[model samples]
Target: MSKKKIKADSTIGLTLKTMVISPIALAYLVYSIFQSQIQSFDSISTSLLLIDSGIVTALQLLLFTKSAKKVSLTMLGILQYISPTISLIGGVFLYHEVLTNAHFIAFVFIWCALAVYTISSITKWRQEQMKNEINMEA
Candidate 1:
C-alpha cells in the first residue's frame, strides 16, 4: 500500500480506538471527581508539567509508529532499547544513580542477546539477497 493510504488507515484506527476509550476514561474521571479523588493542582507549573508529559508521550507513540513501517521488525525490536538505554545512561551519569551487580549482569546479558540477533539477521539478509541475485542471473 501507498504511504498515504497506510497513514490514513492508522489515523482511522486511532480515531476508532479513541472513540471507544474516551467515554470510559471520561466516566472514570467523573467518578474520581465525585469521590473527591481528583486533587486540585497546587500551581500552574504542575498542570503544565502534566500537559507536557501527555504531549511528549503522544508524540513518542506517533513517531514510533511512523518509523516502524520503514524498518525491519528485528531492527525495530533493537531500536526499542534506544530510549531505555538513554534513560539508563542519564540515570547513571546525570542523576548519579548507582548500578548494582544485578543491573550490570542484566545489561551484559541483554547486549549479548542483541549482538546474536543482529548477526543472525545480517547473515539471513545477505543470504536472501544472494538468492535473489542468483535467480535474476538464471
Candidate 2:
C-alpha cells in the first residue's frame, strides 16, 4: 500500500464515480431543458460562467485527491481551513464585510490551535531525526 498506489486507486474510484454519475446528471439537466424548467441563458456570459465554475470544481477535486495521498489526515484537516480563511479575508477586504466579536475570537482560536499543532509536529520530527542519527552512529 504505497502512497502512489493508494492515490491511483482513489483516482480510479473517483473516475468511476464520475462516469456513473455524470450521465445521470447530464440526463437530468437535459430533461429539465426539455421540460422548459431551465429558462434562459440569454447571454454568452451565463454559459461561460457555468463552464468556469465546472472547471474550478474539477480542478479542486483533482488537487484535493492528489494532496490527500501525501499528507496525514490531521494535517489534511488542518489545511482544509485555508479555503474558509481565504474566503473570510475576501469577504472582509474585497466585499467590505464586518466580522462580529465572536468571529474574531474564533479566528484567534484557530490561529492558536494551528500554531500548537505545528510546533508539536516539528518537535516530533526533530526527535525522529535525532533517533535516526543515533542509530546511524551506532
List clashing residue pairs in candidate 2: none
> Which structure among the candidates has the greatest TM-score?
1
Which pairs of residues have clashing backbones in candidate 1? none
> What lDDT does candidate 1 reach at residue 1?
47
Model 1: ten consecutive residues of lowest lDDT: 1-10
Model 1 misplaced stretches (Cα beyond 4 Å): 1-8, 16-40
What shift in Å separates residue 106 of candidate 1 from its native position after superposition?
A: 1.0
Give a tens-digit lDDT track for model 2, residues 11-116: 6766886899999999998998898897645578898898799888877787777778888877787888998999999999999999999999999999899989
RMSD after CA superposition, every candidate: 4.0, 3.5
Sliding window of 10 residues with minimal summed lDDT for model 2: 1-10
